[model samples]
Target: MLIVKNIKNTIKYFIIILAISLSLSIQTLKAQEVAIKDIYFHTDISFEFSDTFGADRYNHFHEGTDIMGEQMAPLYAAVDGVVSYMVNPEGSWGYAITIKGSDDYTYHYLHINNDTPGTDDGNGGIKNAYAEGIERGVSVKRGQLIGYMGDSGNAESVGHHLHFEIRKPNNEPINPYNSLLAALNSEEYNPEIAKELSGTINDDKNIVSSSESLCESNTLIKMADYSTVYYCGADSKRYIFPNEKIFYSWYDDFSDVVILGVKEMEAIPLGGNVTYKPGSRMIKMQTSSKVYVVERGGTLRWVQSTSVAENMYGEKWNTYIDDLPDSLFFDYNIGEEIVST
Candidate 1:
């Protein structure tokens, strides 16, 4: 009886220890998970990004979400991670940093700043690329400022932005779009500061006082005090660029964007919004789930099935789609449904 009692006591003690161990494990996991769940995509003002993961690039698929922002904008760590690799500083992954985040995941920040302060010289070097004390093997906290955005290396022609990616422990890339959008600090968007960062608000003080001095057709114009760009059409009306994607599809850089005074810019009658370059992208309305492919002259042909969408845009076709506001429905005409063909 005595032996049996002792054995039972041992068993009870073991059970208690096991329960305590499990509780501790759960608490640890919850702490790490919470830390990761609240990661902040650091930015002082509003920025823009699109989900282009798995989209076809020059050769390989686009593995990252490009967060478009002003040059020198601060970027933050996506999670509590140890800097696994830092300073790739080559052609493609310019001034890149890789972190071995908790939960066996990884985070990548590429196209980091390589430009001198207040200039696109692309030679800011290590001091400018990373935050103070950030280096390989450095332990970084979640939401800590890690680097600055830039358009270095192959991203030189695309404009200043940060190419952010998340990966599994196996190094397979995953889309960071959803997570980033959820965590982005979208407050304090000052247009005056944005215009100052753009350095284009006052480039063209040659205000138009008469019709002859008005912007010519095919010219891009914006108000001196605003950042909205419009395409001055041959019809003597100005069409809105709608968004960055539509604007980028039409031109490379904003070098030719003429700045006009408010009165002159308002003088031109507003035409409809410009559509995406035909076949370059797909779009869907915010009010509807149905996706449409843009055809010539702003015709939107609905894709009848997923297979047809894949056949038209490839395996990662969904990544190419952008959501448009319901108010712009009149800007496009609904064409025939895209069947298997």
Candidate 2:
């Protein structure tokens, strides 16, 4: 009887362990599916938008992005989804359509064109507004053309453009300017799924990276006996400078890197890479031509126009550019494009 009781207890413990393992596996799969690298947003269009866009009403704020494009320009599905809502005639949203993606994100395409192609008569009707066979409950694939830009609803006099909005599963809005840019430059390579650590006491612990240098920075540090430089962030972790360009972007010279023993450095752990300082320099991936300026934190804002760049940084603005390594692109997040000086 005791043997049987022990056997039953062991089986129960084994079942519990299996259940925990299954739960972890499920969570990992979900994380992979929702990673930022896997997400896509554009089918075929290039337009400007800003997360700071505040197209406010008398009392309401902008809940979606206003994508500046030509009147009657083609509009495509931002994701693979089923059309959930459509409003014709003239409401506040004008001719609008909403798609609910399988990822649980809701894509709102509002203020679609409702006027004649060349006039703002507001009589284009459903045929001019929606794509063929597009209606509520219809399935649509990403980049599939479903409508045209319009001056419908409250935007009758404002201009012709598509007001695109992305809503989370809870229906809250996400600032989609960056995501739209990502979709616009869809050919850009995605970051690796696995990244190796940059700084740690490797097998040759005595000489870190074969050199140690000091610099002027807010919170820079390094192993007292080694040469690799790190930025001691306010978050209490050390971040690698990666290269001289990144180092000089934040400081002029190595006159201030705090040195501590390996024992002291190990206590801080590793944070990541120290991004270029805001307003210090412009950057672009070695493989891409898009120039960007560093904003506060790791936000990378595109230098949208040559004139804007020259106006802000001078006629020799191109000289300020630095080639950011593509592998390190994931270290920063794209922000609103700099359209004006």
Candidate 3:
């Protein structure tokens, strides 16, 4: 009886210790999660991100997140860190700046516009704190304007965007998406400024017009054939639907079908049209050359537009479709010239 009691007591003590250790570990991990104040500030109201971290680049992995913005848009320091390095290379990364934050994470800002006299690498560049007082070894405060967005180096052909990255102390890349999102949704984020810049309000959930509100609720619907699904918003004034081509593989021959995993529906006013500008997320395609027409309420149909094709693919956009195998071109009439609005 004594031996059994001792064994039971030992097991109970071991379990208690294990639980305490686990609790400490979880607390440590939560503490390690980066906070918004540890990075730069956003002066622009509208925030748009293109390529996400961990995306597949041509032959390598994309180590950073690309924030899409117009040329000369302001770029600020994410945290209070010392400028570790600044270089104007000719090819990849163009004019770049790196700061080692006090939090022991390194922040990278790449492809800044190269127009500033002293900072210009002759490709594209911007003047940052290095001109004022923040150079290598110089400390910087969070939200300090470091440079301007630009299309320098290899990005000149791709247009203007800031390729931002966060790295471990040892230089290993970590995903910056969560950190960026946190900053965008924090109290410091200004919705009015986002509206003024992007003409929209970006919340933690989704993008909506500043004048509009996110649907407080949702309802699911299935088509008569049960082949399609749609989400109805609580407003009763708008409905959200999936892109048909994406959901149904309507044009499998031309390109691979891309399903945007949009779980929540973006609320739209009833009977209003949703327009997509160049580089908008609404424009879904495997490549820039192959364009699809997306209609209101989530219906994607076939339409032809010479101007859109030319703008998207220059003058030789048709070559992309011509290269498709004949067997894959069965669905649409090849000669029909249906103009897209």
Model 1 poorest ten-residue lDDT run: 199-208
Error of 1 at 43 (Å): 3.2
lDDT per residue for candidate 3 within 62-131, as digits (tens), equals 7778888777676767877788988734345577788887768899888766653333445332232122
Candidate 2's TM-score: 0.43
For candidate 2, give the lDDT of residue 261. Answer: 76
Those runs of model 1 whose alpha carbons end farther than 4 Å from true positions after fitting are 1-38, 88-92, 185-341
> Candidate 2 lDDT, tens digit per residue, 19-103?
8976675444333322232234432244666654334346555666787677767676777789999985557668999989998
| Candidate 3: residue 182 lDDT (0-100) | 66
Candidates in order have lDDT scores of 0.68, 0.67, 0.50
Which pairs of residues have clashing backbones in candidate 2?
113-149, 113-150, 211-227, 212-227, 214-254, 214-255, 215-254, 215-255, 215-256
Superposed by TM-score, candidate 3 places the C-alpha of residue 90 at a distance from the truth, in angstroms, of 6.1
Q: Tell me how far the alpha carbon of residue 30 in candidate 3 is from the true structure, in angstroms, after superposition.
A: 19
Give per-residue CA lDDT, model 1, range 10-127, as digits (tens). Answer: 9999999988976675444323221223445654435788877766578456777787888767776777789998875555568888878777788888888888767888777776
Q: Which residue pairs show backbone clashes in model 1? A: none
RMSD per candidate (Å) reads 18.5, 25.3, 23.7
Candidate 2 residue runs with Cα over 4 Å from true position: 1-44, 53-57, 89-92, 188-341
